[model samples]
Target: MPIIKLSVSERRRLQVFITCLLLAMAAWVLTTLSGAYHFTIKQVINFKNAPQRRAFKALQSDSVEVTMLGTGWQMLFSKVNTYNTPITVDLHTLEHSNYIALNTQIAQLNKTTDAKHRIVAFTPDTLYFDFTNRVVKKVKVEPVLDIKYQQQYEESGKIQVKPSYITINGPGNVIQNIKTWKTDTLRLTNVNDVVSTTLPLQPAKEGNISIYPKSVQLRIPVEEFTEKTLRIPVKLINNPHYYNVKVIPQYVSITFTVPLSRYTEVDEDFFEATADFSLWEQGYSVLPVNITRIPAYCRIVKTAPRNVDFLVRK
Candidate 1:
């Protein structure tokens, strides 16, 4: 191929022509995007103002395809931004009718968005529901916890939840099967002090089930623990013969961990060490010292002289 160089004036004219073509394309894109257009998008449907006299379960899905009328820019952004605010429909009409007309709620739905974006129609114009007898139930609230305590620290007493129970109203079949509702998992790491906070309960899986007092107050007592050792006498059990049996070591040293608040309250009386003679009759020479009873909040560390020798006298 032969190399051909263009003149300065010809080069300048070519550049201007290319710039004008680019400007025209930009203007066309802006004009088209500014015009009004119609688009369909999926939206979640939420219910409010549920009827008090009857319980209902939706027969159709909780989502519907909504046709919206807006400018091209709004439609483009709506598709790019996938967050669509759920449309809430009032269920108060359900008391008199079994279905809800979505057309009647177009005005309310438009309020949830900007004035330029209008809800034109819904694919399923009407929502149907199945009615049932409503019932009330009282259920206990169970807390779920994932806690990591500092060294030598633990829960001191029982965890208390204010409003230990909550009221639930729903279909009889559904409410009867629910015995306890749990709160969202409360997580804490390296905890060194009492924990008092409010946690929301897990949301109901079935939309028709309603829980009152959505959140509860939690009071967890935490304390630093220290080891305490006490000598507790071992009591003999199942000694029906009434023979004088002498244990080599009559008392055993019991070591346990107790919270600082109740360290002084617990003593030898708070524990009971027992040795069953029935084991000796079953052909054993030694009796195992078992700490049968201990303070509920205390954890046993060790019991000295786990096994003791005994001498039988007629």
Candidate 2:
């Protein structure tokens, strides 16, 4: 191993030679990538222009492997980006035949694609579908809600959906099992007033099912509640013997919460307090007073004198 030092001119020549080699390698790569080539990529399939008179279900998956003819640069980019735009296939051809040949649709499918990257072929080559009788039916819409109301606030009345029912069209076998459709979740927090908004229906799980009017109007009545107390008479129940039974405390004070708008409309007549005499035979000394009925929108706070002494006379 002897140390050898090169002259200044020799070192300069070596540097120039190395630079030229690197430049040639770079030029070769660029030229190769610029040339046209065929490549394969997976693309999602979207069906359009469906036949009007028939319902169809695809026999295969929603995606297909597509062979594309494009420049090497496009192939390089396609490798780096895994997402390929979906190819739309017209189903109007199904009116005559149950199968669609992808090769026949190359021109139509390329309309939305870049001219530089044309569709050469599809892996499946053809698409098949199963047909069934088309049917239309009206189904109720159920709203999904997640709401938090402020203290002393609540819904005053039933929630109203502008179009309570929606029309769905699909294969009779599929539509027969679907009784109702649901809307997307409507979320609200710290709500103290009326809620009115439009919500879109949840998308159909089956691609063949179509819903009319994608959205619906929703109205929820809300109001502030206030406490109200009323003295309601306790009536005896289950006295088949027709014996005279008198409760020691004839009237019980019932306290409940009612919306402000309906405060004046509610009274003792809207409540029914009863004491079951059948408990006497069950070894109870007193009868338990229960609020048997109350308005739908009202919430009971407390019923005074939960138990009452009763007198039985023959």
Candidate 3:
């Protein structure tokens, strides 16, 4: 290969030309970067400094737009870093105004991000809020649950909640409309025994509200049912002193349904069937056998010997 070389005088001239070209390029880049540009960014509005007796709610939304002017370098950083910092809207400073004056807030944001950037205009220009007195209400807390039981099994008792009610404090309008706080939905399937768990209460629709209790304990009693038969004696009670009375059937068969867990605990001893002489005044030769007492867990189906013949001796 053959190479062409330049003399010192020719090389010196070419070097100066190249240097000039590089200087012009650098100057243009700096001029363009230092120029001003407009940018629009969305910023979240954070409410703070609320007094104990007062509550605040934005009429439109919790966030707003922030339009500003900045140099190319500042704009580049803002784009990469996103909105500088969330605008902290002080509730205490909020007063009667068509739109919230964000001059102070935007200035702070600019100081933190880059003082070279200036806030020109807010897209919304302003903000409005509904301020109301803080009010508290006591509302019942109900557990939300979906449960499935095995065949022949059912809830034996009422669902029990540890804390029956909760106290909620918030804006008067919101608190007044609320009646009850519901727990997060709970689900249980194929349950044959008691079910117990703790569930968190659902959050309020309004973000500014406060709830005293956020959780509660729930209990559900479940039991399986079984048919049972208890043979109870029919006693002759309230007999006249001069006469002796005897019922034809000494015992009566009491058939009923009982919970499987309590089936063994229940027997004829837990039941009482009696034939009263007072019924004789109704002009009936036979006396009706009445079940005077039965276990609370038992459901009567049918009884044998509904009526019994009475023998009276004087």
Q: What lDDT score goes with residue 294 in model 2? A: 95
Candidate 1 runs further than 4 Å off: 1-4, 238-248, 276-288, 308-314
What's the lDDT for all of these models? 0.92, 0.91, 0.79
Pairs with backbone N, CA or C atoms under 3 Å apart (clashes), candidate 2? none
lDDT of 3: 0.79
Give me candidate 1's TM-score against the actual structure: 0.89
lDDT per residue for candidate 2 within 1-314, as digits (tens), equals 54878789988999999999999999999999888999999988888888878888999999999998888889988886543877888888888899999999899778867788889999999999999998999999999999999999999889999799999998999999999899999999999999999999999877678998789999999999999999999999998898888898999998899999899999888999999999999999999999999998999999889999999887
Ranking by lDDT: 1, 2, 3
Candidate 1 per-residue lDDT over residues 192-233, each given as its tens digit: 999999999999998899998999999999999999999999
Cα-based TM-score, every candidate: 0.89, 0.87, 0.52
- Model 1, poorest ten-residue lDDT window? 77-86
Per-residue error for 314 in candidate 3, Å, reads: 30
lDDT of 3 by residue, 76-168 (tens): 777775556677765556544323666656665566555667777675756666778889888999888888889888777678897889999
Model 3, residue pairs in steric clash: 99-126, 99-127, 100-127
